[model samples]
Target: MTQTVSSTDPPTPSSTRPITRPTVVGAWHDRFEEILTPEALDFLARLDNAAAGRRADLLAARRARAHRIRHGEDLDFLPGTGSIRRDPSWQVAPPAPGLTRRRVEMTGPVTRRMTINALNSGADVWMADFEDATAPAWQTVIDGQLNLLDAIRDRIEFTDDSGREYRVVEASQRPTIVVRPRGWRLCEKHLTIDGRPMSASLVDFGLFFFHNARELIARGAGPYCYLPKLESHLEARLWNDVFVQAQALLGIPQGTIRATVLIETLPAAFEMDEILYELRDHSAGLNAGRWDYLFSRIKTFAQRGPEFVLPERAELTMTIPTMRAYTDLLVATCHRRGAHAIGGMAAFVPSKADPQAAERALTKMRADKDREAADGFDGSWAAHPALVPTCRDAFEAVLQGRPDQRDRQRDRQGDGVAVTATDLIGTPTTTPPWITLTGLRTNVSVSLRYLTAWVSGQGAVAIDSLMEDAATVEISRAQVWQWLHHRVRLAEGLVVTRDLVTELMDHEVELLHAQATDDRDHRHVDEARDVFVETALGEELPAFFTPYAYVRYLVDRPLQPAQRPTAEDLRRSEVVRGHEVRSEP
Candidate 1:
């Protein structure tokens, strides 16, 4: 039964109006009211009221599934959904406008500067991400909405402290904007409905859709999205339902929303066909979210045994058998259903100062994109603007003036890649002595550094020349837990113990302190260390590190207002030319 909201069908005041107005627990920021209008708050409240129960049920199902996997249950393609996979005639709706030829997609947080940079990055799509790339402070969320609105209206611009301006080009040259909302597992503590924190996923999607769906459609691009961290087909179905209700409430066409689901979690990998089927009417395709997929693998089977233990992070390349099977199956499943198959991110942040380092990074990025192209991926992701050309060139070489290769069905090739359950879960031997002393230290250092930055309201940072986000941090900490839990022996003959991990963490913190530029940076180190210790050395593996850290550091104890940007500060940063960015700053 579909519950549609219309003028005739009034919402229950108790459910729709939780209080006199939507209670904003977060500090008021400049221009937040522009995005969080009374009408918008009501819409979010209604959406949450309708979807909360189902979200809770599905999350419970996830916990149940995790418990079963923890005990003995193995993952396989659902026997019940075999018919859906067997049915070859079904296909997702044709690509929506501006989404047909996505040769390269640039992803970043939705700050004012990033919004300008990504639109001008020359990628076919700009994934303005609110998930891994964003720290999700209250102001950040509101400002992100404002930035997207401004970008859509061609009113966004930014200038650095050096007086260098960044502005969006004319709409003709700009990439299509695709927003990636946060996942289901987190909540927005700032906004509460019925005396509880609202679902972060709904808050993000609702605010964006409510504010931009119709405007984007009028601009010849519908509300495009990249769905992340979905663990099952059921979760996809929940999103489909939300889209239906949202479109109906807004009086938009039913199938206007097109989404590309990131097949990042292990369970989602097994149900790719089902996930696509669930959102078939609105499906764009699936992406190889390699980092979170690795994290999911560790989280799912960490205690199962040594066979499931993976090698160090560096050794877990896309070419590994398990990883190869994942991508091959993704390409096969997507193409078979007439959907595009996108590739993972080339996370290298190329440096021009050191030509050798830049060349090495570009060389690696080119190889990665080239491999994805050959494997039938329609497009790939670039974290930085410099790598966009590399990604596009790779797809162009294979596509050869073509838009996408959905016609290239890898499943029908010679010997027809028939991936099985073992191919995905069964660990492969990749030059043993898995846990090196250096590997442990690197994980500790990287996780601590990233967490410190994250607590300071930076979600994505370039660490060791790679763009490290929450997904990468999850992998880092989760790997440490797995190694410590199993008491894995390092290549240097030191077994992973709590004492050893503590010593290494202290050493890493001291190293960070030595690198700190100010007292604020030093304070963040202690906070970040607390976060690292809680998540990495816990008795039981926490599903995610962000929720707890976010509440403790961001929500409950907010950053000083001075540290956040003001609207006036942003206004003074840039001077926009008429429908074009100034060539000179």
Candidate 2:
């Protein structure tokens, strides 16, 4: 049954709240709040204006076109009041546990080849994503999600290693499929079909996500989606309400629809439990998205150019700490909720473009797989099928207990789960890892923290004896964990604590202490803030925000916006000089 939402979720009535709230949308809802830097303030202000301005412009254009096309005929422009779009958030929702069923993740490059390839990947689910990997083009956004769905369940075809195309009968049984719809701002203008812009409310996008999800459901899957970048629980709740409305319209069951959100933003992180709780009946649990989360952190505190400035993709992928935290947190959060906490992606997928680099990448995969298995991740994803064998082999090998086979279990409990204090450096265990884990509930979070803090700059202190800044604590601590005090069964949940970090690095306590303080220098923070301000005000912003805005800036024509505080020109805000925006009816 779908639960009722509580007041904690922060749902909005249509007239009272704007679609996006800057502070709420930007950060996690933590109890602690900090003053924003002037640059940060400027960036936040622009983000608000940029998202709203583009939305309003798109809305106004629709209204003018509606006036001409129908010659002022009455229209059902907005959905009826008290409909999902206008429901009281909490009143319509209630909390529940173990709301989501099984989950499957989908990811590939944003090429047409990849999109289709992802659809047939041997995963339990698929999400033809528009959020992270896709270049933000509106046509691509529409075409990608709104592809022509054949009525009959078409047999999926793929080329195998031998270059032979075979039909996928039972081989391609994906239980779920979804598309991350475009966000409600500049991207909306780009999805414009014909001469008119797609509305800010994304009436069309909503229909697309709804229609496609239903078709997938009709194909023996369920109505499911992994929603991304949800800044608040209410956002999750809001999506739930939308799903309810769509279901009602489509004649589907009210509670059959489901969503999972990535708690990437700071505010969302703080309010995570609440948000997840609000939509618990329909929520599929949360994901700890690292790159976007870090990017969001920068964006929340710094100026527009600097805040939005991200390190090269390579840096993000290689950041062991970030990846570890994300994977650990996801596993913990999901297991606590009885939902599966899937691990992070394998960033080092080998590319034929660089053979030497590809070989090195394979070596890293071997190391990463060892760590991931050691950390107790149930499953992980890869960008390529070539990496599939590697992933499968790693998961298989860990269960089989290849390396670190020494030491009998030390301390063990909680439903027969065993965790040893003595390290298993090099003893070949006769027992199967799964056999050892029978009836066991392992917390991946607990198992991972001891390792992650080492990589994350948590314990990168100066070495007194080595007399260099290069190394510190985590190395020795990890050696003991990897080779010795083999923590096998009882997996730690993904809740961060200073004790966990310090205790995990117990043997190298002093060295780890020094390494943890290494990031006291804020040079990168300074560089990020400076770059943001410079780029945001540059000529490229109009184009960057929306292709329509870019085109308009060149042609120099006025466009009417549907809502307030719009038009960067303050003078125009006081008058109705620009063209008006509205509906298609």
Candidate 3:
């Protein structure tokens, strides 16, 4: 199903057509066609036509703000939104029906098998992620939506290549389904309205809400969402407005859609109170998205000097002054506004092959959960199903008989947990003793491995027993860039240089090639090197590597009219795209 499009002719626009007559741009699959009907495409078109302009404006604003920061403009809280934060009387909407007891939550990509497993993973909530946790292949995106639709109907099941069967439990035993759509920055190139790509966020949300909002509501749940990578309160406001219009379009109640914002970016941290205030009607809570928060910090202040250059991802613990301020402020803000405060992901995937390692991972997870619980977090995220009980036990100890600790508002006025602008920036004035060669190698290895899997339509990869996502790769490559930019000194007093990084990357690439099981793996290893070097050593850092890589590698071509694409075709496109494109390291 490799669609060969004429570069001379792109998808055509249908702006003058009726709402029911929008055109879908990519090749269609029969399975996906079941969920991506004309009605669904029309709904997405309506959403795009309505809010796409605002989305573009906001993105432009982001670029302008980044330019200001690059020119030494300081970042601080918004004076314009002061009254909303100062008004002590306002609160977010009450928790939606099934989201009230989220002591432990599981998140993963929405493959058919993963979907069934996550729903039965014994957690209070299952966040079916189409964002960082998923590779944005055309088939992967639509298949995910179909999986969720089938799961909602209790007809979803999977049989692996080894013939192992997977199925969901009875409705009474399933976790609450909450979808995390693609961020606002991404566009669904496979689908378009008026020849313009629609926001991936709206496409994911539109199809899911259009189909499942009524079904979820009928079953005592609502169309709950987790908004990711929002950098400002205004972004949250855009999502709130989308939620409002989505509910109304489907004839559902205004407050039926609930969303939790991931305060993962540096700017979003400063505006946590305002973000909640904007979406108060449909807000669920704010999550301490630790990895992305760290990545955001580095990206924001990468040029600010060695003060902001992080040593290693593992060294930046949650207990650091900056991280503590973030969590403390998040808990306080959510509780102040009657929203649940969710903690960050415990991404330690347990290994049965090594009992001692599993125990160590569990112990670290226990400590992390205990800290969040003590800090008054209502719930937290687990990347693996095995760690769910451990997380539950940690929170259970603190929760006692209560569903959540939203009642335990650690307010600055009363609890003495004060967080300032300086604390949020969390820059260390002093330099570390040394950066290690092992850290550099680890970054290269992990980034390469993760990028390989990502190019193959897998987003969440378990490497060295840690669940790694796009944020993990972002931090990995960004650190290399930051280290090179600062000429960071190693433990042996040698300054890290671009040549040194290239040498190490070449060695790692050779090592991976030796371990390659086939030509396909070898090519991925090669492309991984290309993507890493391009992103890490470029004159200007690309905002996100996924989108650039996706357009260049994941898509084969435009679909022929009435032609059906297959999963195999999508997989082949990755290899085809890899072979056709080459970049210098």
- Per-residue C-alpha lDDT of model 2 across residues 8-84, encoded as one tens digit per residue: 43433322222221221122222212222333233323333322333444334333433332232222212222133
For each candidate in turn, the TM-score is 0.91, 0.50, 0.91
Estimate candidate 2's RMSD in Å.
Answer: 19.9
In Å, residue 545's CA in model 1 sits off its true spot by 0.8
TM-score of model 2 (CA atoms) = 0.50
- Which is better, 1 or 3, measured by lDDT? 1
Model 3 alpha-carbon miss at residue 418, Å: 1.1
Model 1: per-residue Cα lDDT at residue 569? 24
Candidate 3 residue pairs in backbone clash: none
Give the lDDT of residue 17 in candidate 3: 35
Model 2 stretches with alpha carbons more than 4 Å out: 1-104, 109-112, 146-148, 155-175, 184-187, 190-205, 303-327, 353-356, 369-378, 396-585
Q: What is candidate 3's lDDT per residue for 33-90, written digit by digit as tens?
A: 7877878877776766556655655665676677667668778777767677678898
Query: Lowest summed-lDDT stretch of 10 residues in model 3?
Result: 576-585
